[model samples]
Target: MRADIHIDSDLLQQCRKGSSKAFRELVEQLKRPAYYHALSLTGHSDDAMDVSQEAFARAWQNMSSYNPSQPFYPWYYTILRRVALNHLRSRSRRREDIDNGQIDTMLTEAGGPGEDCQSVQYSNLVQQALMHLSIEDREILCLKDMHDHSYRELADIVGVPIGTVMSRLYAARQRFRQLMKESGYEHE
Candidate 1:
């Protein structure tokens, strides 16, 4: 599920007023979703944790710039996305090599071909295709598809217009479908 929280303006005001407790509450509400989002971007649990924490640290340091009128998570997501992209750039590598052994293990762990096997296989195929996609494509897909962010939320988090979000998400999905086809997996 999307990592959503009702961050009331009073909480933001308290945080802006140097209330450590309030900021901690904010962190507590967001940390899990932030980490999982980071994981989808970074593909490594440790890097995901580090990226999410660093983003939070940056967000806290720049709290004064936050506008109370705007929703908090989208703003926070902007920070997190930048940190994750920066992390990806610095690493200069992508984990695109999910070998057969790993895939076999993953499939085996799901048990023999049952009623849900096709769904499991499709899910794995999509995930594997995502790993091979550009960060931009993966980010857009993950935010829109996986996290269920609306176009407005995506536009805010991506610093783009709503039309741009629509276009980007469409293009990303096209690429994803092509990748899945190339991988010999097709779903209607």
Candidate 2:
């Protein structure tokens, strides 16, 4: 997820001076994207909530290191990504409870799974197909498609050149299309 708004310089200065209100404001602007971004990586609501909060705590602790001249999210994203990756690493050791029911709810909402069983089945297949993607692929698709980020924002958040972002997006979509085909989801 990307925020088009730049961080207020005054807010940064105040935060640097230990102003709690300024810090809270900054968190308010970011916390939703941060949580959704973490959710994209972690694939579990609980893990996303925990890791996102932890990343914010770390961001506050390391506030002095931030360059006020730069866009805040790219730097903040580094911290969030590190924390999320570490969580993924540790959690890989354990059996993750795949919450398919929760996923069904999400798909139903997005696909508007109505009276039609076919659409529900399609949504489920799409959800399962997403699980087969690499975390990077899934993250890019969600950040760009679901979160409505521009290519420039995508480049910044993903830390890649615009061309690479374009190429990766193409490849990810192509792979997803293949998955859908293989899963028997015909185009409407």
- Which of the numbered candidates is closest to the native, going by highest lDDT? 1
Tens-digit lDDT track for model 1 on 1-188?
A: 46574587888999988888999999998998798788777766677889999999999999999988888888898899999999988888736443322323322344655637677677678668877888789888878877788887788778899999999999999999999999998577
Task: Give the TM-score (vs. native) of candidate 2.
Answer: 0.86
lDDT of each: 0.80, 0.79
Task: List the lowest-lDDT window of 10 residues for candidate 2.
Answer: 100-109
Superposed model 1: Cα runs more than 4 Å off: 94-117
For candidate 2, the C-alpha RMSD (Å) to the true structure equals: 2.7
Q: Can you write out model 2's per-residue Cα lDDT over 29-56, one digit (the tens) per residue?
A: 8888887778777767788889999998
Q: Would you estimate the TM-scores of all the predictions?
A: 0.85, 0.86
Clashes of each: 0, 0
Model 1 / residue 176 / CA error / Å: 0.2
Top-scoring candidate (TM-score): 2
The ten-residue window of minimal lDDT in model 1 covers 98-107
